[model samples]
Target chain A: MDTLRKTRWLLVMLTLAACKKPTENIKIVIDTDVIKYTALINVTDGQNGSPAPAATTIAITGTAANDIFELSGKKDIKLSSGIVTIGLRPTVAPTTNQPITVTAEINAPGYNRETRQVTFRAETKQQVINIQLTKTGSTAPPVVTPPPPVFNNVSLTFTGRCPNRTDLEIRPSVYVYFKKSDSNAAFQYLGYMDKGNISTNLLEQGGTYDFQIVYGAETYKVSQKIDQTSYNLTLDMPAACNF
Target chain B: MYFRRSIVLLLAILLRCYQVNAQNNNQPPSLLGQKSILLNVGTQGVGAEFAYGVLPNLALRGGLNFIPFKAHNVFKISGFNSTSNLSADFYNVHALADYVPVKTASWFRLVGGFAYFFKAKGDIRVIPSDDYKYGDLVLTEDQIGYVDLNVNWKGLAPYLGVAFANTFPRNKFNVSFDLGTYYLNKPKADITGTGLLEGNSSQTPQFQSNIKDYRWLPIVQINFSYKL
Candidate 1:
């Protein structure tokens, strides 16, 4: 009986030690989209579709300009790689008949000043506006090229990876830039990626392209060879997101 | 080894007391052959058990228990008005042994048991309430989405407690109160979300850390037993 009691005591101690944190190594994934009804304004050179100069500035002026905010919920929006996403602040909404309109003015050295009207309609939650510029003196008419073949629709899912903080992730809601992997051409405006998912018909079967997004002044890039209808891509956001 | 020796010494003292009482009193107020089935309800929910006196001052009990409950609007997140639905289901079957050390005061007993919890899960889903606005646009329920937090701790748990009355009926019927705790197994927890809330999954680490030490489940219960 004494031996039996000793064994029971040992068993109780062992049971207490058996408890280990089951979720110790688990990683948490979080989506990045908080603001809805956004428009991605992408500025580029009209002739070659190259990114605008680093000194380029964008100014919003209109009745609804004050209500617009960056996707990160900042009022003072700054362009990264000549791209900035503008959205109606969470407190505002657009109606079909009364669409919200804002004038986006782009100015850069040696480039003709340009202004484009961006409209946010109630029916459309996400949009992309391309603002192409012309040089001050160059009278080169906008090149009219033959339309490319209608490629199959391809969907891409972008997941942000944070190296320092493995638990932090971002389902990026930002403008996407894509270019042919073999071409020296600059990245062109693809579309607005909404919470990691974007579908476009520009990617041909078997074609390879490099996709890029500039967030927090850092350019993150990922490459994929288009083969299937859908692809999952990861963008390294080592700094993660502050907002 | 020292702990084992201390428990042995305590048991020896208790045995000596019982032996002395047996010698002084001829009958010793026998509790043996006392058999009863009890219906219980309290913090651990509702349960039914059959208790039988196996020794002059000891009884054995085995039973099953279950509790299912749900509550709403218990949580909020970051100024977002959320309607939280919390639901928990726990079902267990257990067997326990009671040792009444003092023969004169047999009502007080030390109890130990092993309970096998077949289903123990707590789930909370927080959905943004109606009138959620994103800028000027009111979001539909599907667009705003919901977040679900789930925790499961189901396995064999050890129970230890003290009972305030005889487990078996003293007369035809008797009521008893018990205070105890069960050391539950480690829990598995996860957070998932849909729509705009899908990013809430990243909060799993914080949630895990907050709940890591929640292994002890306290119980305060009332049991009514009837002798056959």
Candidate 2:
């Protein structure tokens, strides 16, 4: 009877021993200093340009319809941490882009969370990732407005010959303007010429334009005006615009 | 021989730890600057790789890497492709992990990882429009502006791929090559910025796609790392 008892104890101990490896425990003993990621409610992610709620929890799902990825060593990932990694299996492919997502909650207690959306980004090989996290209680962030279109600070105005096309190329002159205006009758010399011609500025952020076109002996006038409302003249050039 | 190799690896690890700890010792080193430098070279890449162990049924592996690549991107317009090579450089970084649930002398490794890419710079030039008759026509620099845009700007990109490698003879050096592709965002252009350094952003008068994808550039490289 004693022998039987001893054997049972030995078996129980062996089973326990099999479960633990010194190295395996190292990952779980995370440094308390490890910061957990949290964010406030944010605006739409490249969406309608509006504010949204914070995320609740991020669940890293699997690959896309025709994708593959193995999250192996990532098994030790902590849920509480901002970054939770999954494990990949051997033979699982590799990728240059990390496709992972997280879901967010708009509001919560003591924690401020935010909401965002994930869309199809053109990237290379493998899985689609999604991770949604919840936020603690906090006030929502401000709504974002669609940024006005920006123009090239520097314009490319050059004088070159027409290779094959004819009846074009009227004494090479690059038009540089700040805004467009039909005020030929308004202030005379410095009103505003629509951003109709290429090689000039895109007339950005209500500004004054200094028009100067050095063509032949004719000296066109210069004008100055505040861009209240302006539009880009698609001036419609060939697919091969060589200016 | 296997036993001898194990002893060697154990000693190597001990030596490394000893060296690291010894740096804390103010005492002069007995062996001088004879500290060995071990460079682990492997081709497992940024993804997953599997190795089989006859003695041990299972094993684990993880890899993180970043590689820089230089490419000469040719801009094609209308029907003409530029022969005047305009090149760009970009980088990709990611972490790779592998698992071998099954056991054998040569175990199959399931691999997977994430990829991050840096945008590439491209060159764009505008073909101006001066003459307009029937169809879309290109004219002199006077009539239109040549907007040459190069997508060689830098941006982050990611990727994932897996490969299998077999270790030969106990634990000699092993060689395995990997091929994979990740996402690449067309480098954006700042038309406002100028000068020769501009590399032609103001010239790209038009673009067809908003977020163009240049993800087809395949990555092929080899890996070689020694097991401790």
In order, what lDDT does every prediction score?
Answer: 0.74, 0.31
State the displacement of the C-alpha of residue B193, model 2, in Å, after optimal TM-score superposition.
7.2
lDDT of 1 by residue, B1-228 (tens): 775695586456446544554454554455677788999886567899998888888788999988776666544554345688877777999998888887767667899999998987778898767675443345567766888889887999999999876666545776777778888887787788898668768678767775666677776677888888
Candidate 2, DockQ score (0 to 1): 0.02
lDDT of 2 by residue, A1-243 (tens): 244333332322122122322112111000010111111111232222321223324333334312211111222222221222222232233344643333422333334444443322225222223222223332345333433345544332222223343322212212222224452311111111211223323455455554433111122334445344433321212211222
Instruction: Write model 1 residue lDDT over A146-177, tens digit each, in one string.
Output: 34456889999998887767644677887788
**Candidates in order, interface RMSD in Å:** 12.2, 30.7
- Output the lDDT of residue A44, model 2: 30
Give the TM-score comparing model 2 with the true structure, all chains together.
0.33
The ten-residue window of minimal lDDT in model 1 chain A covers A8-17
TM-score of each: 0.65, 0.33
Any runs in candidate 2 off by more than 4 Å, and if so which? A1-228, A234-243, B1-73, B79-85, B101-107, B116-158, B167-169, B184-211
RMSD to native, candidate 2 = 30.8
Q: How many clashing residue pairs appear in each of the predictions shown?
A: 9, 118
Cα error, residue B143 of model 2, in Å, equals 16
